[model samples]
Target chain A: MSGPATHVRGKKTLARSILGFVDKGLVNAVLVIVAIFWLVPTLGLFLSSLRTVGDSASSGWWTVFTTPAQLTIENYASLLSNPTITGSFWNTILIAVPTTVFVVIFGALAGYAFAWLKFPGRDWLLIVVIVLLAVPLQVALIPLARMFGTLGIFGSIFGVILFHVAFGLPFAIFLLRNFFTQIPAELLEAARIDGASDWRIFVQVILPLGGPAIASLAIFQFLWTWNDMLVALIFTNSGSQPLTVAIQSQLRQFGSNIDVLSAGAFLSMIVPLIVFFAFQRFFVQALLAGSQK
Target chain B: MTQLVAPVANSPAGGDKRRPPHGSSRRRMFMIALGFLAPALVFLGALVLYPIVYTVVRSFFSAGGGEFVGWDNYVTMFTNDSTFTAIRNNVLWVLVAPAACTILGLIFAVLLEKIKWATAFKLIIFMPMAISMLAAGVIFRGMFQENPNLGVVNAALVTVNSAFGQDAAYPGAAGRDGLGLVQDRGVIASESTVESGSEQNFPLVGIRVDSVPAAAAQAEPAVNARAGQLVGTVWLDVVRGGGGTSGQIDDGKTGLPGILVDAVAADGTIAASATTDAAGRYVIDGLAEGAYRVALPAANFDEGYQGVSWLSSTFITGVIILSYIWIWAGFSMVMISSGLSAIDRSLQEAARMDGANEWNVFTRITAPLLSPVLIVVFVTLIINVLKIFDLVYVIPPGSAKPAANVIAVEMWTVSFGGGNNQGLGSALAILLLILVLPSMIINIRRFREERQQ
Candidate 1:
């Protein structure tokens, strides 16, 4: 056989061998493992949340099967009913919603600026921001708290909201900017030639087409703000602790009542998961889309 | 979101000033830009910027408030005190964890995602990812427990040990439980009035585990005490020369020294501790049946720091960088793979027909086409790493043995860990937000640019 034919045949054989291996069911087995990896903790968290305090600590949640009827809803009932938890849950919602909304709105705008706007110090500002991204969160906490004290906003919902907004803006901007930047210049140019105002153009042309990007950005910001413990712990007072702080504060010095924590942990994750799966289709593609650029 | 509308501002401002019937439109555009941006900028400036300025000022002043010390705290931190140690340990963490995690993450993302069990692999790695830093610390602390660390890491080690047919050398005979033992016995006799007597009365004591059958019978497991591994037990004993209290050693094998006061309080606490023997040996066993930490005193510590938190603002920064690389690499790979897939098949066929080699076509055509996505990925990752707190915080913060501390974790620790000084903690926090703000703006701007494109 000629060299090209030989090489082509070799390549085809390799491909065929790979396909044959997949056809033999290795791929399916792997998928099951993947499903288990993702599902187990979720299942563990779910099962653990429902289990008795003793069961959760002494053994894995899988052992719940020994007495199939042993599953209890008491944890959930208690979680919802617990006065502290109830307040915190509501507080989390309050903190999370506004923080997420603002961050996304701000992020989208900043992203657009980086992508399309010609302004003084754009490159320098970009460099500065890149450098800023590396600053540790620890360095900022104390000063921010002091600032809050001066503003009389410390230990309140406002303080926490402000903190989340500040922190969340960067990531949202980072991801959204990449997504917005990739929109073909021709599209915006077309709108410009048509005399579409920038705001009109953004709202009409960019925002609509940027749906997938926005969805992902919103989801991330939502999860981040909702799950954030440090800012909430510092910025809010007794009346308005978010779930993470509330749950963490409940930690008894030696060992806490693991059951409540189990319940609380799972509950906290609920929104993110729901939000994630709710937008799972958008996420699957966009997870790497903006990230690549 | 106003930033999202920035481009709209561009058209009516200097960029498109000559547009017909645009006198009111220009005013409307400026109003829109201000309207869109005003709220966020207000919130950010009030919450983030002002605080950072306070920290920069605070860092130079004394706690009691005096004159501008001009980087005195910075100087003191670098020149003296345990803060230096914290910096060192943090540096090591920055160097090690992030780079490793990111590289591992990238590899895992690429390989594991392709596996039939891709989700499972993702879940396993991401399992740690999802857990809060405090929770992960608790879990890891358990996993890396000090005596027989009963966590997963130690269990694996024990399994490995069993496979090799090894055991702790001897029972607790390595040291007296709480009693003191002399370390050296000089040449001169106790009653000697010789010129060298002052240096001669050094106490020398040794445990005869072999001679004491019972002592050897209850020997604990001796195991590795590698840095940050977290589980193992050790003990040490000291016998006094003249019925005098020298120093009571606890852990008998090889481990760092921490006080284990033998004098039990009236409450009758066991106060079981493991202090290393003269050879710096301590063996801690029965560690709740899992992984544990065993450490030896450092001969000399080399300084490394993980940088201050929010963004990894240090020369020794590591974890953040690694994670950024990992996520970005994976992201780029995904995009590139897609881009590769999207390449016009007809073009490749055309190239083949023209007798161009595959490598030549790929270099000339594929790479250039892939550039946009790659740039987006790298820049976004740099920004993402700046904003990230989750992965770094999960590690915990400490500088002695590379405290798994991240800036975010530090913020949580200070704000909640109940310190005597809230002012300092707040200062640190304000600094964190300030540091992140500029980047936040950069990211948003990048987003706007992207959107406009």
Candidate 2:
């Protein structure tokens, strides 16, 4: 008893020392540096947008302390009020939120079948879906854009959303299917025996249980659409442009108002951060069966 | 793709085992599969399979129905030497950026998990990742704008140069005397890419430089005067061709080194100049070219951060690594976290009761069982990395010339960027697909395997 206890005690102390070092300095320092690394550029952008063209050229935003004190929030104020960027923000919302919703709903339904259904070619269908996930987005873009243009949806927000949903479905389905398989089959069989229809079974039995998968999938789709610059650029024009495209227009191959950009970027990010935090409980990707089986 | 059969409770060979379902159970399963999977299949075939097949067929025949080249594009990609360099560069990018970004992301994730403010810290690090590379490129391009000390990087360099490195000599000295030196302010439309950001600053032009006393410059006046001079301030625009030849400075056609005054400042506040002497050259004697600058009083070099607003480009030397890491790691972390959470807690408690420390519990008791998740994460992330474009597309190359464009970028540029050369773009893209598909297939197989387990 003494020998084992002492061995455990020694190991615990070693673990403690390692944890102590990490907690005391190394980890905190890394996190702080990483956070700052990302933050400074963003802040620089904010400062740049606010400063006059001359001031931006003459000095960095960080150097504002030594310079003539002429800081202003005009960049943000101006950009937020602009018709193009402002409108695009709404367009982005329309595209992102709906795409997220569609992908989750469809992916969950499809995943449920793949997990529980015993149909002809069930295994083949899943394999085909996985292979579909391998398709590069670029290879599909031009052709899809052409198809969309032909269908009269290319220039519209709907086209972009549809494209995102279509692409997002495969991976989303894959994730949900994987998650669905881990759930015990007895629960589903019990619900079925108790006379639940397929839809009822999905909604009452599986939906609540599938929160984490849905949330993460939603997060993925939302971010993809929100930050989507490529499809939007190709399919949509000036009026339908998203924040990324709008911001790209502001850059004059020579110099740009950085402060406005930083402020604008921050503004663009606000919703995602909120969504991420709001969904933090679901953020724990494996709370199924108490997360630990 | 290898077909993964159903997750039978036990191997069919091992007794009747948990017995594969029969009768009504089998029929209900077929109904479920048909109902749930059809929507996903239709979309996949329509969007993904159609285009890939189209590209493969289209690449074989040329734009105007040229004879089937049958691997000609692939041949050119490898044999055309320049294209090979591009492939090499692409390989370099794949090697450096993905690994660095993943490592950094994992490191940051692990580190940040400890902080009370971990969420806040993660937001900050991952924040850059969230910002479209397009925005990032622009911001960096501006900072790298090369007016001697005008660019942020140059300004920092100037501060450091003044603080550490020497201020350059005055502009009076003969040009091309031995070494021709001049300092001129550079311009950047994008932010400065801090590749070599930890640079010393050069002193502001017209200040310390003017004090070099024109007499030292006068030491070679006859020699300098004989050298061709810019009677008025001149702008030398380097175009794509005019591939330079080595020669002594000649008037008009050659040699800004041909001039006594290499350049008059754009503002005219400083007549600071370089003198080029006999071997047909003039050296701007005193100049601080240490940082935040494009030394236009010279040639062949522009600021490293010239972002291409044309066709949408930003030249960030560092952001490539930064962006790749954050995104990939963020995804990997989700997998890691979820995988760990999936393990039964009793096992953890059992280790605890047995006196296993947290480390031992995690490593010995945990990681072994977590192999499924690790495999899933590794395979998925690798697949994601293989076809990465959106993030790369956002970051325009940060140089006058990009170090290398991602295959996706190459595809877009080749296809629609003016030349209307769909064949080449399609070919490059097809090649990219060939490279990525095997791993992707392997990943799917693994995913199916884990699901079965």
lDDT of 2 by residue, B1-453 (tens): 012234444233211122256787667655665666667667767777787787787677664446677777767667754446446656765666555654454445444545678656644554444445555555555554555434555566556655653333233222121222333343111122111112111111222233332322211112321122222221121111444222212122222223233233334343344433322233333333322221333221222232223322233434454546644555555445555556787786777668776579767877788766555555555555656555555444334234445666666656754546566667777877787787667766765664566
Model 1 residue A176 CA deviation in Å: 4.4
- Per-residue lDDT of A1-293 in model 2, one digit per residue for the tens? 12223344555666655656655586667666766655565566666666766666565667675664768776677877888878988888888888889888889999887766556676777777777776667777657766787888878888887788888887787778767765666666556556667677788877888777777777766776787777787777877778877776654344445555556665676666666566644534422221121
lDDT of 1 at B105: 40
Please provide, for model 1 over A1-293, each residue's C-alpha lDDT reduced to its tens digit, 9 standing for 90 to 100.
Answer: 12222334335656645654664365456545544543443455567678777655555455566766769998999889899999998999999899888888887777666666554455555544444444455555767766788889888898888788876665566677667766766678667767777677778877887888898877666766776776676678879998887776655431236578667877777766666546644554545653443
Best by DockQ: 2
After superposition, which runs of candidate 2 have C-alpha atoms over 4 Å from their true positions? A1-23, A65-69, A252-264, A280-293, B1-32, B64-68, B79-85, B109-120, B139-162, B166-319, B326-381, B390-402
Comparing to the true complex, what docking class would candidate 2 get? Answer: acceptable
Looking at model 1 chain B, report the run of 10 residues with the lowest lDDT sum.
B194-203
lDDT of 1 by residue, B364-435 (tens): 765576555545444444434433454444323233213434434444544455543344444444434554
* Distance from true location, Cα of A261 in model 1, Å: 2.0
